[model samples]
Target: MSGCNKKKFPAAKDVVLLHQLDRGIFTPSISPFPLKLETYMRMAGISYENDFKNPMGPKGKTPWMTFNGNDYCDSQLCLELLASKFQKDFSSDLTAEERAIARSFQIMTEEHLYWVLVLWRWVYTKGKTLWDVQMNLPTGLRLVMPLAVRRIKAQASAQGLGRHSKDDVIEMGRKDLRAISDYLGTKPYFTGDKPTEMDCAMFGCLAQLVWSMQGSPYEEQMKGEFANLKEFCERMKEKFWPDWDQCLSPPRLNVS
Candidate 1:
């Protein structure tokens, strides 16, 4: 769990070495999948360290991990690995139907909502807002952002969401948000009063709107029309991320 160093590559016994982007002044990690994995680790009480160096894993994705002297990639697969190893089952108490619902919600957030957020951050905003808040980003990355934008645009187009207008994309995101809020209702967590694995994915995507994406229509809608969603984000933040501010670069002040 060393800070600002990758020389200590292999984590201590039973400690997870998470490879992901550097922290931001606004959020723990800019990418939701990384944030999702990190949140799952925290929720499961698994000891871990943050390795900003070599963020990309074998699968060429950020937020990969090294654990028990083994390397792992893909955030969802990483979650499964950690869950099996740690024996942490947040959804263990759920009914079969509830588990099915949780999986569906996770897919909706990660698959559908994630693309919309990406379009807004990387494509629509052109990574300006994202770059502005990132701490100590490399000069190379700044130079490569244009390529990254093109890649994302191409991916979005292939996914079919990019074919729609910006307004249509915003509406799609709103529908997803509304569905989540409706399901959440007054529950302290997504299902019942206790957090589950699905909550990690849910919070990962929702936290972006709460803190990272400034002036986004989705952000405004969540803050205004979807009071429950806002409350759920705040509740998850308070419960799991007590060091949320400290985790940020140049630690954000006056955070509510």
Candidate 2:
């Protein structure tokens, strides 16, 4: 069959993504996991429909997937389920050691870098101000946003990243960026010419740092100090996102 002919057939199954709004644009919510899943699906060449039902899915998190008739929560679990059902192997070509390395990086980005993001965005005063402005809460509810902010702070503290001082947080983030840069070197992706789950994780976090958190100190530091990561974000954007330009555009805050 011709390549174009294959496009005529509908996808074997329907995949509905429940996450934040503004798909194909910058990270829409505070979390990057949802964007990671979306990017991974795109990279895997899977057709799926996006449904902005709520920021939190049935599991009280973003990036949950409903495949055919079954619900799968958690991005990693969703990826595993998709791979198993569709017979798609994202890491098939990887050696045992390579898979280990990739998995390590994935965990580092999620556990460490993710907390750095929370510290910068939810803990720091300047970051909180920008976040609030972008959030654009109503005048009546703006007074109560602090309560929500405090909840986030508490969550971050429990996660152990929000307890550090701002300088410490920045230093931690710098170390992570340096590590990712060193590992990537001149490679096109984390694993080599082809992208992997690790690449998805890295891109998801870096994209938010480089693009979504605009005007923040973290974003400035990433762009200035980590040129390679910035370039990698651009590469992934160009490769996986058809509307990269739109995604890069600054979000339209609903200030009313």
Candidate 3:
């Protein structure tokens, strides 16, 4: 891709201009992948800026970024590349076996659990839940919401998650949560005391349930049986997102 000649793209060297969906009322981003990448940047102390101008990048995915005028997409790939470039290894302390376990948890959260949430938010719930959190959506997006839901519905069906009943999807999510909870045990973070790349991805998904999936059983479970996970969300938010409230949509107005 050409250098950032477009006004929306950042021209600064060695600085990441993150292009992702607009922020939501309940979270900095209702989309987990972008939030994951942003959280990774925050944790690694990488210099970056958010650009809501172009939500879709070359690969047709949100959470893409421009570094040194080069565009990169895919949240996980971006995290790995940026980590190497910055010499930051959140999992550098992990043993070989521990690394394997962390990889498994990350895959479960991103692949399986992610589809579950997508089905719930788009297909099963018919985007009602998403509308609740993204209430301040732009007029253009409001017009496109129906088409977005249909596209997700087709994608979920193609992925086989939509073939299952709503109850089945919920059960799958519950089981995934149970596995994560059991593995997490009592550790302050996913891997151990300190957060890792896995935690960045995990928190990206779990925070959605904890904060944005209002009135859903998953939200209730996160706050109930999976209360530890809820606490984990709180911990991650406190550590990486001190400006959480300020990052919300409609902008939180401060009063003296």
Candidate 4:
């Protein structure tokens, strides 16, 4: 495609601009595949590196596994989304093995901070306090743990499920976030460094949290919900979403 294709979803060069993992593994996580590659994605903490000097950070994280459960070619979730959207002649479409793998994770319907509770509980079992982006990970790590906790608490209370809610889930998410906010807190971002999966995950959870909190008289009491969380999301927008309007994918080429 030419650089000036009036509706080029992403300029051809920009199409693969900031790839993180395997190119094939990336598209879907960002949604609608092609457009996601045209835009940037948050890739701070969830990545695995050999050292502080990993030259291949841009090569994209090695696929955790292939969709086919054999040699790694791509991620299943990404493969299906691309296949369904593009319907292409190229053979990278999701295979039967890939479809089976995608089915495995269907149990997790939790979105945003709801899943953060899932992750927090998984990690809390290890008693690991100090977090290093390179070493500590569960993919969707917490950026602003306190905000995530607060958001999850808000999530559970959404339907007056407070008493009916699994108190343990609420308490786990709450105490983890509250404790982190209370102890060694508010550093500008997660890990007191750059943003990571934790930041994105926390941002995912709290974007709505802060949006909802705005204009309320309780803003002052919340300390702007702690500046670090707010700023981190802003930084995320700046880096990954320079042109939010460009997020939609273009019409498929109909390669077949």
Candidate 3 deviant stretches above 4 angstroms: 1-8, 136-138, 251-256
Q: What's the lDDT for all of these models? A: 0.85, 0.69, 0.86, 0.33
Model 4, residue 68: distance off in Å is 9.9
Better of 2 and 3 by TM-score: 3
Measured by lDDT, the strongest candidate is: 3
- List the candidate numbers ranked by TM-score, top first: 3, 1, 2, 4
Give stretches of model 2 more than 4 Å off.
1-12, 23-30, 126-141, 246-254
User: What TM-score, to 2 decimals, does candidate 2 have?
Assistant: 0.83
Give the distance in Å from residue 140's predicted Cα in candidate 4 to where it truly belongs.
33
Per-model TM-score, in order, reads: 0.92, 0.83, 0.92, 0.32
Best by TM-score: 3
Candidate 1 — worst ten consecutive residues by lDDT sum? Answer: 1-10
Q: Model 3: which ten-residue window has the lowest total lDDT?
A: 1-10
**Candidate 4: regions farther than 4 A off:** 1-161, 164-177, 180-186, 212-225, 245-256
Q: Which is superior by lDDT, 1 or 4? A: 1
lDDT of 2 by residue, 11-90 (tens): 24655444444343354433578778878788777778765534455655676666655566788888777677677787
Q: What value does the lDDT take at residue 188 in candidate 2?
A: 89
lDDT of 1 by residue, 1-256 (tens): 2122243365689999999988977889878889999999999999998888778777667878888777878888999988988888888899999999989988998999999998998899888777556765666766789998899899999998988999999899989999998999989899989998888888888888888888888766776788888898888889999999889888434422
| Candidate 4 root-mean-square deviation in Å | 18.4
